[model samples]
Target: MVTRALIESVLTRARERSRLLTDSVDDGDLVAQHSPLMSPLVWDLAHIGNQEELWLVRDVGGREPVRVDIDALYDAFEHPRSTRPQLPLMDPAQARAYVRTVREKVWDVLDGHPLAGSPLAENGFAFGMIAQHEQQHDETMLATHQLRSGDAVLVAPETPDLGGTPEIDTEVVVPGGEFVMGTSVEPWALDNERPAHAVDVPSFGIDTFPVTNERYLAFMDDGGYERRELWSERGWSHRREAELAAPQFWEWDGKSWWRRRFGTMEPVRLREPVVHVSYFEAEAFARWAGKRLPTESEWEKAARWDPRSGRSRRYPWGDEDPDDTRANLGQRHLGPAVAGAYPAGASGLGVHQLIGDVWEWTSSDFLPYPGFSAFPYREYSDVFFGGDYKVLRGGSFGTDAVACRGTFRNWDHPIRRQIFSGFRCARDVQGEQA
Candidate 1:
């Protein structure tokens, strides 16, 4: 049953993150330009909240607000990012109040429809649209935080001292077989994960934990960037073009490595999961370590457990939201935890941190399954395919739980490294064919 809990949590977090902005400028800054991709923080905050209310209440529940001013207040079309500066803005207090009111209305509607299914039952595609839309905005918010803080190279947050021993090395070997990939049941799945179908993959062994800073650092120390042999042709080209040396936030301070995170500089934690890497970077590091990335099929197969055989839930650990002792998400500490911090989040195969901490890059290209069909927003998937894009799984520190799903697929070019992306490694068993 649909509940307002997830939506409410997102709004609350959005407000908290926004309040972190050092700039206390009021509504006048809402339409002011902060960056090429970011609109005014105030404007985005109000618009996103209104977006939730509009879809969940007005569009889905067939209810209209007495005040139609929101249509103009949060109208994104006429007041596009390009023309933000020209739009009249709302005061911060006013905008915050509006967001609260909209959230209340959305919750009221959601409460009324306790048994509401996916967006389909309420507002058709509108619910999904708003959800996806807000996620994109959330991404923008993270980027804006970096931009505003003048921290172009943010580092992963320090891992808290959680006393948990790493699971002794355990491996899951999924036999080569054909299984259905993509969403089977109707879901708020993005267009990219649509048109589920069967795909066969060879057997492989995956590490239980994401590659850690200590592990990835070995590649860097071994000249992973300077060594062209480890990279794909495209990757090498990107490396050369971007003047690759090390992770975006990493720097050799002569004595030790240091990283820039959340507008602050700090020493690199060797045990934490390596964040701020691109698909290409992950691939290069994997190759250097004499391993390869798991294909999406392989990744999913290892993550989802079959109850008949005592396998756990679809998520790496099980069907549960992350908590402080589990995955490092929802700004738990404002950054990633140690790579092996959460054994509870491990898959049946003992793969740890598969659901959160940092997104893991996969070997598979961003292509649709067989019989793929576009969802409501065609741009979501069809726009990105073999066009030199790659798939990433799990969610990052800044990602909300609603966006964190085992099947959720994220894509990016092989070289861009502004996100909190990381990866794990997979390899064929000793006797299996590669």
Candidate 2:
């Protein structure tokens, strides 16, 4: 399955995503600090190259590093995001030239190497890893652009009006049963998602779509933010300390809501899944609505459940890879499509937008599965396994196809509201059926 074509396709995706990250902004914007939480765009530009060089060239191909002298400069672990700006980052052109130089050699490596000898190269995992890494940075860089001011530097055709969207809130019933929770077959699946295991989950009812902006706005309108009882002690304190009136980038103009998007201030899109909300916010909203965030297993079963086959799917819609018509991914459009937009992409139990829209927050704290082992490096997923972070399932609009899968797991600090995170509620059925 790890054909040369597949390897080249992954490389092309990485190149395309990198171009998208670097081409939109001027050199000044590349180094400018958009947020202390994010690295400079130029930093990401070179870091992507650095990762490729370390893995594809030095590690896999058994070649000397093209830029060993600058390796430490781009080591993400060495420089925290807050201090990255102060480091001696290469200029955008230098970074671009360096990556291009690295990539040219990487292609040569891909052309002649034996991809079967190692796990990293087997199944084109290393190429896919590099592609996924670059695409992830592309998402981060898009976040930077969203955080930056002045004027809208990015543009995408508005999300389609997928007309027959479900209205009047309803939940679908997922019968209690045993199901495969993660994956062992997916070639590019990350380590945390490894060693697929069986999970016995009770029957539950889950929202047909992600919690929409309109529904969340209703929570805010009804004093969801003011009521401490609805929030956890930590959540309430964080909300109070930060004074989160609404999701990040939102402003209630007293009359109605107005918010900033890529740089344009406009009314919030009502039907899209609420994005940039913290775990606390999601939990608070769930409390106000008298529901709960689904456990990681519950979320996966809902999205991947298949009655006929009694198995988990690779995506909400069965196993064929994502296409633009099927899912809104690969930064094809910046903002999420309207909720209930992709009927074809819904799961068998009628869950919509489960694949690409927003990273749905789950109730579970991130922990490793049974027989879990880190491959290549521990820094990727091993470092974040704890209560300090909450898991988010599904992928966002900015997520690329190569990086996302039904079992793909994303995690972040509970107080973070800057990333594209959202949630859908799940409730136990009154008379559960096993």
Candidate 3:
């Protein structure tokens, strides 16, 4: 499955998405932030390219490539994320051309070699890691574009009037039982999804849909930020020290409201899922609404239900490819569809839109399950858990549909708000008695 063509496909898509950001000479300091959260477009392009060469070629060869300046050109973690790199900057045209050259060279070298012979060489693992890493950066670039330029696209559904919230009187109940919690083996699975094992989950109720912009607005109107009682200790601290307000793109236009999306402006959609909220924000909203966020296991169980079969399916919509009619992924609609647009993607218990729309926040921290072990790349899972990271479920508007499998696990800081993130509420088996 690891082919040069596959690698090239990933690289080409990454480059195309990166180009979506329009950086001008007058934009001043092309570098945005220095954190690992996102990379400056200039730095992102070269860093990713160099990483491909470093792991696939240089590391495999036990030597650096001949002409590239590995140290001076590609070292990004050393400098702050906000500081624009002083290295030779390239205009979009020149930068893109160089990227193509590097990509071709790397793919050629990889294709010609018999890397599968040595598992420890980590050629296969390195290739997948870098490919997925670039894809993630692409998503981050989309978010950063929305934040900086006020121009991120939010799309309406292809077929409108698909019904908003259904008339369900109560949350869907998931019976308690032993369930496999993590991933086993697949064509490509991140290290965090590994060491799959059984866990006993108590019965519980989960919201049929993710929290919507209309619902979150109610929290804001009730002075959700001003009231510290509804926030967790850490959430309260983050709110105070950071002076957090509304979600990243939201703007109060006096009598009404608007939001900046994909380099364009639009009136906020009240019924749509609230995008661009951090874990802290989602948790606060849940608390204000007198509900709680679900754990990742609970999310997985709820998403496996198939109403038609009364049994679990591998994905929310059964074991099938995500067609355009089912979910709002792959940049097809340009951005998000209304939360209820994908009824077909619902879990067995009638949980709608669990796979793709916006990634839902979970109450759990990012952690390894029992019997955890490191993958070829040690930095993948172990390095991220110790930080203040939280887990997210489903997939976002910009997430690659191929990468958003049901068992796939994603995580980020609770304070980050630039991504197309959202959350749904859940209750304990005892109905808040727990």
Candidate 4:
């Protein structure tokens, strides 16, 4: 049940996450675009405020807006990120003041209301929506930090070695059955993940852990990128256009490979999940390995379907929320843990890292559920549904738990290599062994 205390906690978390991004950088850093692919950090900050105002104050509480002049400046689709710096964006002080004002009024409304009846207020969904929104932008800002040229402004203790020998039984055989593909009970799940429906998945063998750097390096060593036979037509064209030899941020220095991470260069961690890889890269690797990517339904069945109980759990680890030992999440560490890490977080069928580490891309297009209905707004997921986009499941180190769950769905263009993505290969099961 949604309570006042829960609302306050969510608001505090959203505010804290925004502060982590805003406080670490200078005023100039906030307005300047770190990369043409992303909005200026300041735009995200104000846009956080703008969305909170739109959903919480104006839409939910029915209050007058504190400022309307800044709305267009924060409208994400209206201006491209490359062109954002040229716009008359708010100075740092103004942006802070604006977010502060919005937060104060939004809190007043929350305190005044019973937070029920209306769909937006029901189950504290609007507040949850805003919290998830801010956390998402915070992750976006962190990506901007990675794309930036300066020294690392953020730091965290390195993730521990969750060491274990890679299993020869590297894949799990998910039994063929009818499993619920989406959700109807999870209150905070977004519109696209709604109206749970059944899907009949034939038996498949999915990798126990996400594909690792050691494994992907082998593919590269075998000339996987150069050989046009391994890639799809669109992917091969992209590979030639971008000259992609390995995952983004990786380079071969004659003898060995080194990767740039948060303004520092280090030898790649062979055991960690191969991250920053695009869907095309994953697909090519799968083809090179003589396997195939899992369909969206196949992926979900492996992660959530609990054959014993005959129900889908909220996570691979069960219905409990993610914690430090359970999964690497909430920017606790900047990168993925080793592939064999987090054994306790594995699915019922022993599929590992199904919750966090990196977003696992599937061989499926972003599409609507059977009873797809646009809720609150269409821009959230509706506009992007088509064959042009690919679906990425699970979450990453930067993903906040408020924003991530087993039913959670993330999509991006197949060519996107920047925002902490990875994948594991799956193939049709023969008998019971993978």
Off by over 4 Å in 3: 1-8, 21-38, 59-68, 71-76, 84-94, 110-115, 120-126, 150-170, 305-314, 431-434
Q: Residue 139 of candidate 4: its Cα lDDT?
A: 85
Clashes of each: 4, 0, 17, 0
TM-score of 2: 0.98
Better of 1 and 4 by TM-score: 4
Kindly list the per-residue Cα lDDT of model 3 for residues 1-434, writing each as its tens digit. Answer: 55656656766666565555434322332354423455566667666666767666676544447437544556655555555444565545555566666667666666676656665343365666666777776676656555555323333344343656664324677777766666665546677777667777888888887877878888999999889988999999999998888887778889778877756767888778888888888888888877889999999888864444554456777877677767777555545667677777777677888887798999899988777778766666787876788899888777776567787888888888777889899877764321
Q: Global CA lDDT of candidate 4, please?
A: 0.87
Ten consecutive residues with minimal summed lDDT in candidate 3?
21-30
Tens digit per residue, CA lDDT, model 2, 189-252: 8899988899999899899889999998899889999999999999999999999889999987
Q: Is candidate 2 or candidate 3 better by TM-score?
A: 2
Candidate 4's TM-score: 0.97
Which stretches of candidate 4 lie above 4 Å from their native place? none
Candidates in descending TM-score order = 2, 4, 3, 1
Local accuracy by lDDT, each model: 0.69, 0.88, 0.71, 0.87
Q: Residue pairs in steric clash, candidate 2?
A: none
**C-alpha RMSD by candidate, in order:** 4.5, 1.2, 3.9, 1.4
